[model samples]
Every structure is written in C-alpha cells, then in structure tokens.
Target: MEIDELTPAEARIWRAFARGDYVDFRTGPDDDPADGAAWGPERTVRARVLRTLLLDGPRASGEIPSLDLSGARITGGLHLQYATVELAVRLKNCWFEEVPRLYAARLWEINLSESVLPGLIAHAVRVDGVLRMTRARFTGLVRLAGAEVTGSLYLEGARIDAPDAEGPVLQLNQAALGADLWAPGLRARGPVRLTGASVTGTVHLKDAVLDAPGRTALDAQSLVVGSSVTAGCLDARGTLDFRGARVPGTLELTHARLSCPGGIALRATSCVIGELWLFGDGRIEGALRLRRARIDSLSLDPDLVPDEVYLNDLTYGALVPQHPAERRLQMLERDGDGYVPYSYEQLTAAYRRNGDDDAARRVQLAKLRRHRRTLPWYGRVWGRLQDAAVGYGFRPLRAGAWLLSLLAAGSVVYALAPPPALKPGEAPDFSPVFYTLDLLLPIISFGQETAFAPEGPYQWLSYALVLMGWLLASTVIAGVTRSVSRP
Candidate 1:
C-alpha cells in the first residue's frame, strides 16, 4: 500500500515501524524513553493504527511489520473483536493497562510471553498457530471460551491470579486444540476450567500449582483428549474434576499432592480412559471418587492411602500393582463403606485370566469373608456354622467327616452298653454296629432298636442317637444343595 492511501495515524505508525521504534505513550522528543525501547517517532501506535495495519496490510508479501512493543506500556486495551490478522503479534515483556479483547477474531499466531496483563478475553477466536503465553502474568480472568487453536497452546511458567476467588483464572470451556495443551510450571490462584474442551494431543500440567480451596482447582468435565492427560508433581489445593472425560491414553497423576479436606479431591465419575495411574508419591487428603469409571488398566501405589476413596461401579480390565496380592487386597478392604462385590469379582477375573487361580480363589475367599462381616449378627452366626461344618458348602468332605464321627460314637455307646433283656423263648441277638447304622440311616430298619427297647439310661442314649442322626443328615443335605446351586 502507498503512503498516501494510509491515514495520518497509520502513516505515522508505518514510519515508526520503518525506524524500528517501540510504540508507547512516552515516546516524545522531550521524554526519555527506556533503553532498548524502539526508535519510533514521538507518538504511540494508537488502536486505529493497529486496526488499519491488520485490516489493510498486504497479505501476499507478508510485509506487515512485527509488533515489537516489548517493555512498552500500552495506554489503552487492544480490541480486535471479530477481526482477522494475517501476521503474527508479539508483545513480549509489555504491560497492558486493560485486558486485551479478541472476541471471535482469527489470527495467525500470538506471542505474549513475559508480559504483564490485566487479563485476556479471546472467546471464539481462531488461531492458525500457537497461542504462546509462557512466563506471562495475568492479574484477572483469561477467558478463551470456545476458541480453536490449530497448534499447541503454551502457558508454561505462567502465573494467573483471578480477581474473583470463586471464578476461574483460565477458562477454556468448549475450546478445541489441534495439538497439546502445555501448562507446566503454572501457578494459578483460582480454578482453571477446561470443561468440554477437546485436545488432539496430550494435556501436560507437570509441576503446576493450583490454589482454589473448597472449589475446583481444575475442572475438565466432558473433556476429550486424543492422548494422555498427565499431571505429575502437581500440587492442587481443591477438587480436580474430570467427570465424563474420555482419554484414549492414560490419565496419570504419579507424584501429585491434592488436598481438599472433607470434600472430593479428585472426582472422575463416568470417565473412560485407556489407563489410570495414581501410583508413586501421589497423595490425596480428601475423598477420591471414581464412580462408574471405565479403565483398561489401573496402577496404584502400595503405600498410597487417601483419606477416603469411592470406587462404586469402577471397572478396570486389569490392576497393575507393584505390591503383592495381600497388600492390594488390604488396600481394597480399606475402602470400608465404598467396597463392592463387583470390584472383587473384577479382580478375581483378572487374576484368573492371568492364570493365577490361587490368587483368584484367595480373592473370592476374601470377598466372602468380608461380606460375612458386613452381615447381621444372625447371618454371621449362620455363616460361621456353615464355614465350620461345610466351608460354606464348598467342603463336602467336612460334612462326611462329621457324619462319620457321629456314627462311630453311636456305635461305641451301643457296643459298651448291656445287651437288652431277652423275652421268653427269644434268643439275644445284638450287633452294635448294625444297630447304629440302622438308627442313623432312617430309611433302613433292623430288629435291634424296634424289637428290643432300651431300658433306663439306654433309652435316653437312644433318643440322643436319633437326634444326632437327624442333625447330621440335615446338614449334609443342606451342604449338597448349596454346593449344587452356587454359581
């Protein structure tokens, strides 16, 4: 574009760019501009100048000058709402008096690293390249709601402090990113919301520190990530909600420290992930809710003991624990109220699939024992009796042993006792073993007990023998039925 075609402000900005001057309010001849500041004319680039450059600059030659307003104090906020920019915007080390607005705008790329701004409002904006804000500091909310980035979104070493404690410091709700969302070393004083956001690559938040006590420190509900969501070494002070999120890769929190006493520290209800890792030095002070979550594999640290954990309906294909089976069993048992039979069943199946039948049986036995403990007093008593007599109907041999012992005792009693008195012209014929068997069998009959009745103490002994026979028979029958009917 020719110089005459530009307005006075645009021309002035063009000339200042030609002279490599930094656009600032105090760039006048009388004023002493800071060292390393641009050598522009004694005039700041007004918002009109910026608008004209972005709207009218030639796109073919890429002749748009780089906005090197580093260390310059922008008097007014930059408003690019609904505008399109073909050039990159670099405002490194700059200070903004007001938050920049880029609502619904399309830009090539943005670089605001090391800048101190009130905040940013870039709702529905489309960036063809990265939205770099590394080492930047924001004093207010940085809203990127519904924005789409074709490249990664970098916020490493950034510090965000929202004015309102209840509001999020960085809001990316419903945003779509073509690449990863890197936020390592981030320090946010308020919650970071990424609700319903979709990322094609990983969401890395390693070594980040978030402080939003009694509220969500990081909320990524319904988020869909193509790769993993890793937060190793993260220190979060409030709830980290990942409800309904889907990740094809793992959701790892290897060395994170979460604290939200009496509240949910991590709530991942209904989430589906390839793998879940809460191993290593991760510690959660509050409850960790994983209700209805579906994971292909889960890895938990042996020593990790959250204050409270809920695992209702939480299904996993395998449990990858470094600890022994006993330790893992203990961990599951510690969930007291949250423990469910299906969880134990799932573990049993996994172990069985791995050809660890012993472990699987042990898990089954533990489950039964735990369930028995949870039963009422009467149920428990019955369970104990079944266990001792028939091993909950699993040990048929035990029932047979009790029957044998009763038969032997009855035989000895009858053999040692005096023979029954003979009637007139009747010969005394008594076989103690046969007599015991006949009485105990109930179906068969021999003349001993019926024809020759016991006298005195032997009569009481006969009644005792009949009662023992009935009890033994009933227990054996019940055990057989239970064993056959059990799944």
Candidate 2:
C-alpha cells in the first residue's frame, strides 16, 4: 500500500492523468483563494485518489502515489469489499464528473489502462481481473455494458463499449441492446478488439471460448450491431473478423462454431438482418459472405445452416430479387438432399419478386406437401392452368364460364317449351321459318306485343311458370361458378 506518493503539486495532477488532460472539470475551487477544497491543474488524480480511499479505509498497498489526490472532489461508494490492493490503479487521464457512484468496486487484477471515462456509473463492476479499456473516451451512459461479472470486457483498441448499451451509441453508429453482454466462459488470453469502433450494440459472444493460441486476429470492425438487438449470439470460434459488421438483429448462428479465416463476413453495406437462424453446431469453412446483406427474414432455423450451406449475394427478403429464382435458399443442401423442392420453379421465382405468383405457387405447394412425395400438386395445378391457357394468352375466366353455362342451359330448355300460338293470322307462323328450321329452339323469344293478350289458358301457364323459374336460377349460378373454379 505505498504507490500514491506524488507531490510536486501532485506531479502536476499525475501528468494531467498521463496526458489526456481535458481540464475544465466544472470550475470553482478558486486555487486556495481560501478553501472550497482548493482545486487547480485540470482535475483528475482520480478525484484525489478516490477521496483518500473513502476516508482512509483501505489505503495500505502503496498508499496511492503520495496523497495530493489531484484536483480532489471524488464522491462516495469506493467500497473495495475484500481489500488486498497491489497497485496499477493509474486512472490514465481520468475526469469522471466527480466519481459519482460505483457499488461493489473490487478491481482485482486492475489496470484500467488508458482511461478518460466521462460520466461512469459503475453499477455492478466486479472485474475479478483485467479491465484495460485500451483507448477510452467513454462519455455518459456506460451502464456497466450490461453487467454480469466474471471479467473480460477488455476492448482491444477500444473507443466505445456503451454510450447506450440499449439506446444511444450515437456520435454516428447509433445504438440499441438492452441486455445480455455476457462474456461466455471468458478465459480471455487475448484478441478482442472492437476494431475501428462504431458499435451500436449487440456483441454477445455466446459460449465464448477464445483460446487464441497465439492470437492471430479477432476484430469486429465497422461494428454497428443495431436494430435494437433482440436475442444475441456471436460465438466466435477463433478468428472472427466480421469484415464490415452490421447485423441489424437476430443472428443466432444456432450452434455457432465458426473457426474463421474468411468465414462469417456477412458482407456489410448496411447489412440489415432480423431472422437468420443458420442452424446446427455451425462451421463456416471459409466464405459465408452475404455480399450486401439485408435479409428481412431468412430462417433456416430447423438445424442451423446444415441443409448443405452455400450462400452469396443473398436475397431472401427485404426486397431486391426480380426473379432468377429469387436465389436465397442458396444451397441449404442440394445433392445429398437436405431437401429443397419448394417448386413452381421456386414459387415462380418468389412470385416474380413478391407480386404473388398464384400466391407463391400456393405457398410452394404448401411447403412441398410438407416433405415431398414427388409433389404432383395436382399436376402443378394443371400446369398452371395450361400456362394460363396457352402461355398467358388469357381465357377470360374460361371463356366466360363456357358462355354463361350455355346460356343458362338453353334458358332452361326454352322455358320448358310447348307454347307456340301466334296462329290466328296464320301467316305469323311463316311455316315455322319456311321448311323445318331443324325444329328450331336455341332461343327466339319475342312475345310481348299484346293489345289483348293473356287471353286464357292459365295465362299461358302463368307465363311459362315465370320463365322456368328464371332459367333455373340462372342455371344454378353458372354451375356454382364452375365448381369453384377448380385449380
């Protein structure tokens, strides 16, 4: 407990916190113009060595560089529960707006490397060891980056970890991730940089087994894991180099076993993800490129990408495919058969880019009869109605339902025939149209010229029983719309 020994005016506030020197820590101590706790050279000796270890409770390890306590104004909660201090508490260029609060402050193998931690609120901070924040400037909302304890939130060439572990990584690179930043099992040997840091949120690291034998590379560049992150699972099997990372949401990678080299590139260009399950104990041999990813919904969730993986320039949703077979089930297993056949030539190339080719070929024949049997799908619905009756020439609803069901069944057989009395003048018959017009009756009704008609005979059998009940209800509604328009 002897390291707090500096005094030539506290070594100029510890070399202005080793040179980050921001200065104006809210003004006023009036340089001993007679007490107000006398402050001067830019502030931060970590608030007077943490207010002399919270009023002298645990200051023996090295007594903190000899007490001048730099601009002095540190506040409460410096409770170092187990007390065993060794030294290396160099709050680099620290200027925390008066060390507001930090509960279980157990900085075990401490080294807070290069700090300038703006408005920190160390909620559950129990770094049982290393917390080296490489190149810090962490303004406000650090919210413990979703505190879970165990250690290893390191940040290699770090610029930002949490401006809003859920709402604001602003400063361009937006943000969003309410929780789950759990560090897997965390035995971190090295390799964990938020490369070129612009992280909005989600850097989960599920099952985190970073053994980094000699550490080749593990950068998470241009990182903008936004879209308010819902689940979280970036399991890095070793060399994860998210080329230009931008995962908008659900990127489970199911059993995430990526051994990386050229694997997981999600080819960023504002890559907007949401539903990308990529199933089973993962293994991206080299290229999972997703060229310019924006997949709104592509869940291969069943086993997690083993329907025989392929991927490239992917286009499953979020619109962009004009029909080269929409191309996104990109080989989730082909030859050995991890099942494909969502036919109608891939639902007519995803309904010609989602216009709805006969409802995407009836949901690709109802998901290919739920698992195939040589999908006849009614002979592909009579070959798509005979290719819409011969290459989309058009049938006008089957020639207007076969000429309105043969004119409503020949007007119900000529209104049940047998009433041909225009005989009084005789010339009216005109010999039934000269010589037997083949017993003519396809329909020729012209009988309403009555100055005194309806003379009797039950009024012509009540006008032929109301014209045979209106041609039998128009031939039973055109034969029930041609039996529900079959296919």
Candidate 3:
C-alpha cells in the first residue's frame, strides 16, 4: 500500500513508524471505546496499514524503527502468520476489533500492556525479546502453544476470561521460555494450561485467581522449571495439576485457597522438587496427590492438612515446622487410598533424618497397627497379641513388663499348688520356680515339665501356660524380625 492509500490516522501512524516515534491517538481521557466500536476514524488505525508499515516500510538510516501506538483502536485483523518483522510492537491502552494473529511469526519484543483484546493466537511464534501483556484483559482464548520466547513473558495483573471456550483460556502448552514466566496477579476464569512447558527461570503465580470449578484450573503436567514456582496466596477453584513436573527449586503454596471438594485439589504426582511448602493456614478443601513424588524438604502445617491424600511412594528428606511425631503420623494416615507401607516408611525416614529415632520407632509401630487392619481376622488377632505383649517390637520395656507379669503369676500359682510327680520312683523333687520356668520357656528346658504332671485344674492351667508361652514367643519373634530386617 502506498502513502496515499493510507487513511488520515494510518498516515499519521505510518509517519511515526518511519521516524520511530510513539503516537497517542486518544482525543480525550484514556477510556475504552465500548468494544472499539464507538471510536472515530481519527483514533482508529486499520490493521492492514500497521502490517504494511511493519513489513514494507521505508528502510531505517540509523536506529531500528518500531511501531509503538497507545490509546488507539485497531480495526481489522493484524495477521502476521509466518512473517518476519524486525521491530518492536507496543500497543499500550489500546482496544482491538479483531484478535492479533502471529502464528509462527518471528518477531522482536511485543508489549500489549493495559490493552483490551478479544484474544491472541501466537502459537509456535518465535520471539527474540520479552513478551509482556501486563494488566491486559482478554475476553477470549489466548493460544500460545509451542511458542519459543527468548526472554521473559510477563502477564502480571492480566485477566483472561474465556470460560466457555473449548480449550484453556490462556493456552501455553509446550511453550519454551528462555527466562521466567512472571505472572504475579494473573486472573483467569477458565483453565490455564502449561503442559510440557519449559522455563529457564521461576514461575511466579503469586495471588493469582484461577477458577474452573469441577474441572482442572491449572494443568501444568510435565512442566520443567529451572528455579522455584511460587503460587503463594493463589485462589484456585479446581485442580492445580503438576503431574510429572520437575522443579529444581521450591514450589511454595503458602496461604493458597485450593478447593475442588470430592475431587483432587492439587495433584503433583511424580514431581521432583527441592522444597514443597504447603503451610501457612491455607484452606485445602479436596484431596492432594503426592504419589511417587520426591522432595528434599516438604513443609506442611498441621491445620492445613486435607482429608483425602494419595501418598504412596512419596518420599521427602525432611518435614518442616517439626510437628510432634503423633501429628505427623496423622498426616500419613490420611492417605485414604488404603494402606500403603511405603508412605509409613517414608514418614519414618523423614523423622529419622532429623535424629528423631524415637519418633521413627513410633512410626514403625503405628505402621504395624495400620497393617493389621488390612489382614485377615486370624492375622489381626495375632497382631493384637504382639502389640499387647511387645508393642510390635518397638517398645522393649513393654515386652519385659509382659514377660515379668506372666513369670510372676506362673511362679506364684505353681508354688501355691505343686503338681504331682509323674514317675515317683525315679523323678527328682520338683522346684516350683523350675516348674514355672519350664512351662513358660518355649525353647529352653529346665527338666521339671517332664518330671511332674499336674492332674485336673492344675493340668489345665499348665497347658494354658504352655500355649500362652508359645504364642508370646512366636509373636515377639515375628515383630522383632520385621523391625530388625527393615532397619
């Protein structure tokens, strides 16, 4: 298009593009023209004219020319599919009639700060510099799948509402970023996806509001981040998934309100992170998935625990706040996914890492008690015997007390009523202590059990003592063997 073919507003923007100057076309206060429909021709620049200026404008003499327009209404679609533009595009406080299409377009910096647009489609678009959409509002979908951003992408204070869209409201699946995804106050009505995305720096979602009730609000599966991904104070209504994600730094969710009710609230299965902080009195309304996740430091608050959790094979180096062993044990039991031994072992290990061997032993005992519930009736009965006599081999003092109590009772009863000698002609005189010891010892012999045979009630008591001895011995052996082999 020639200079004469451009409109008066387009002519002015074209002149400014050549000279590399910023143009403010608003005649009055900076107010949005309702849907960009009420704006006059003086403030409306057709998208074709801007595209021509970016692609076929006059050559620059010294500095690189840029297209920076503010407070102007953009009419028609600014389609730059597969095109190469070597300049910056800054359209601050502007309103668009049609969404900008930059599919597979290679460009420099692009800033749409405080602009109101229908949506954006820049999937597979390669950007050399920063892509900032600070405080911008989108009423439709913002697709940026497979985009390669050389610099950081900032979406602070931006609002993207496309609750009725077929896909995510802010689609950024598989995007590769050279720097951080710094969105501090982002608000999205529909789901915001970042599946398979890679960021070299941190992902800041602080105080962001993501609402997609009965669905996934943030689907960030397989996302790899170099630094921390902080979602502190975030208010999400649906699941915030991080399945198979790898974050080398902390994933902090302090003071976050995550609500998904009978569904999964925050799923981070198989995530490998430095620290996972879910503390600070946050309200977690649904289940949390930490199945097979490995973290260095897992900081949790007792009051912030969710009811249903799947923590099988989830290992952590340490648990912060150093809650009492009993409190931490309750957290492990909340794994409503049934009895997973690995969860107990992992929690015990976390306690042991801090030199709390006593707490670790308690956890082991609790594990046995929990396992008993999943066994058959006979197994459970045997388990109860071990617990009563030996505390599942975790408390040696309790085992000693049980042994002493049984020994004292047997010795007194045998001393009070001595059993008759079996072979009176050859049998030696039987000592009451020796007889009681012989009946109680399952393996060791004191030569008195065979020498004397009690008749009637005394015989019944002897048999009962012998059976009790065998049961106690077997249960103790099994519990001790398990504890020793596990450690």
Candidate 4:
C-alpha cells in the first residue's frame, strides 16, 4: 500500500484521489477542464492502478475514500472478481473500452450512473448498498446472475442493447435483492430475464419500453416477490412470461400495452398471487394465459379486451369490476376459445361467497348455456330436449307438468271414444277415467285396460297413451338422476 512500491500510474491515481480530482484521460489540452467540474479528470489511470486501489486502499473514517472515476476512459477491463471493497465506487459519466468483470466481488456500493459501458459481468457479486446505474447505457449484455444486493437495483432511464437477438439485455437469474428493483423508463433492445430471482420489495417498471419481438421480452418465471410487481404504462412488443411466479402482493399492469400477435402476450401459469390488476387502459393483442393460477382477487378494466385469453383452472376469490353485471359477463365472454367450465364455476363461487345467491345462480345458468353451445350436434339435440322437457334437470316441475298433460290428453281420448267390450267374468260397469289411468300407469295396473278389449281406432289410441306414459316416466327419472348427480 506504499506509494514508493506502487507503479507510476498507481502513484498518479493515488495522488489524484488525495487531491479530490476526478480522473479523465479523454480530455484535450485545449479543452476547458473547469467545464467538466467534478466529473473531469486531469489524467487517465491504468486499469491495474484502479484494481490495486480498490484492493489495498486505506480506510477513511470507517470506509475507503469514494473512488471517483467520472469521465475517465478506461483502457482495459476492470477485473475485480472476489475483491472486497468498503467504499462507494463512482464511475459516473465514464466510458469503458471493455466490459467490467466483477464476478463474486463484494462491494459497499457501486454507481455507474450516466456511464457509457460496453457491458457488465457481475455474476455472484455481493453489494452492501445500492447498485445505481441510472441513465447508463450498455452496448452489450449485462449479466448479474446469482448476485445478492442489500439495497435497491436502480436502472432508471437506462438503455441496453445486446448483440445477440436471442440473448437477454439484462440477466438476473437466481439473484436476491433486499429492496425494490426500480427500472422505470428503461429501454431494452433485447429481453430482460429474472428467472428464479427473489425480490423482497416491489419490482417497478413504470413506462419501460421492451422490444424483443417473437420472443420473450421479460422472462421472470418462478420469481418470488415479497411485494407487488407493478408495470404501469409499459410497452412490450414480445411475450411477458411469469410462469410459476409467486407474488404476495398485487401484480399491477395498469395502462400497459402488449403486442405479440399469434403468440402469448402474458403467461402466468400456476402462479400464486394476492391480487391482479389489469385495469386502466391496458391492451393485450395476443393470448393472456392464466392456467391453474391462484389469485386472491382480480381487477380488470370494463373496456379492456385481449385478443385471446385462457383461464383454465384459474381460481380467484373475487372479481373486482366497477361495471354492471351485464358488462362483466360480456368481458368474461371475451375469451376467444369456447366456454371453460372452471372459469364460470370460479365466478359462481365468488358470487356465492359474496352472499349474492341470485348472481351466482345467474352465472351457473349462463355456464350451462355456454356449455350447451360448445357441445356436439347430438349433444345439442339432447340438451334442447332436456331443456324443453325438464329444464336440463334444473326444474323437475317441468317433467311433472308434461306427465300431467299426457295423462289429461289420454283421459280425453278415452272418454270421447266408444266404450270397449268387457271380457268374460269382468265387471259389468266400465269407467273411462279408470281405463285411461290403467293405460297410462306402466308400473302398476288397475286391470281395467287388461280386461277390456279395445276396438279398431280405440286400440291405436290406447297404444299412443301407453307410449306417452312411458316417455314421460323415463324423462322424469332422467331429471331426478341429473339433479342428484349435479354439484
């Protein structure tokens, strides 16, 4: 750590730090240094000097003096892998010729705000304070895989451009953050990945622009967020995948615009969330898949419509809609695919839990209608018959009505017809009502129709009565069976 043992470049860097002067190698003799202020450097420091300073610098107060490399043009890569530093490293407005590699390094805090860098490779790095990169621009991939940060990761107004189309602009797989991941106004030319990451605070991406068409723009599968994942006014041209993610707080996407035609705009399969808010001018051009997701509550805009939506096995405790019931029903009907029974069932359960039995019944009825429409031709026919005769087993009274009508018709026919001849040893008197009843009742016989012999047209009339009676009996049995089996 002695200046005499340090190289000439290291000595110069130490002297500049002692004098509180910002280092700069890109400034010309004719250029006014005062114009650059604290960001302007008198001379450039070698990469080795910077590394040595970070590794062996003396502590000031309780930490090393803040290393200000603002406006400095670094010659080579700054490799701080596994190095421990106790002070803030400020590289504001600097330009890096090579990507800085900080793999497995432990730092107090690092600020690359407003810096133009090739990229950053900080996999497994640990930061005790904020990783501030506000307004910084990256020309390549910024990988932070397995990183642990005790403070927020700020990337406000940051612009990232990756060379590979399929690679992510920012990779944060398995990263753990103690605070919020703030990235408002971020513009990424490639995808942003956060797979298996855990954020203790909210992940805010308000007004961010992501353009990774035909691919995943934001892949946060299996991410565990302690708070909400809010992305208001976001414009994403590709898919936003959140499969198997768990959010204790709401996942808000207010005023967002997502377009991934012929592909999924958002997929949250098997996710568990406290609440979901897709209201306030949000529009998704492709399918929004929520298969097997468990949401405590859902809030959707009355007018918002995605091109296609899949809610198979999606269970929500409530549907918080500000619109009327009719409008809400219409919105539920917006799913491009045919009727899904679980969606209707989930809604019905929600209404029932809210103590609105009437609404729940209405939803159940609607579910039946929608299900009937999706049935095959033969199923439709059977359904219609059941509806007409027994109200799809919902109103068993209708079957009773049919039976009464058939019985009355049989009585009228038998009464108007000529009297039938009685067999030998039979009763002398003949009662038309008793005769009709005997023909109509298939299970029990009063012996009136069996002892009597009907003539010509009367025989045909009795046959008709018997057939009608059998049909009504079968329909009633079917209705009862259905009612018993229904959930």
Best by lDDT: 3
Predicted candidate 3 versus true structure: per-residue lDDT over 1-487, tens digit per residue: 8889888888888888877899987666747644567778888888888888889987558756899998888989999999999899898888899999999999999999988999999999999999999999999999999999999999999999889999899988999999999999999999999999999999999999999999999999999999999999999999999999999999999999999999999999999999999988679999989999999999989888888888988988888878778998887788877889998888888888888899889988899899999999998998899999788888757766776777888788888888888889988887887787788888999889999998888889889889988887887887788778876
Q: Among these predicted structures, which one has the highest TM-score?
A: 3
* Distance from true location, Cα of 155 in model 3, Å: 0.5
How many clashes in each candidate?
Answer: 3, 27, 0, 3
Superior candidate under TM-score, 1 versus 2: 1
Ranking by lDDT: 3, 4, 1, 2
| Candidate 2 C-alpha lDDT tens digits along 208-252 | 544332232245555555443221334444555555565667666
Off by over 4 Å in 3: 4-7, 26-36, 411-435, 443-456
lDDT of 4 by residue, 95-165 (tens): 67788999999998899988777889999999999999998988889999999999999999999987374
CA lDDT of each prediction against the hidden true structure: 0.78, 0.41, 0.90, 0.80
Model 1 lDDT tens row, 133-248 = 99888888999999999999999999998737447889999999999999999999999999999999999999999999888999999999999998999999999999999998
Candidates 3 and 4 compared: the better one by TM-score is: 3
By lDDT, the better pick of 3 and 4 is 3
Please list the Cα RMSD from the true structure of every candidate, rounded to 1 decimal place: 5.8, 17.3, 2.6, 5.6
Q: Which stretches of candidate 2 lie over 4 Å from their true place?
A: 1-90, 93-103, 106-123, 126-156, 159-295, 298-307, 310-323, 326-330, 335-337, 340-353, 356-487
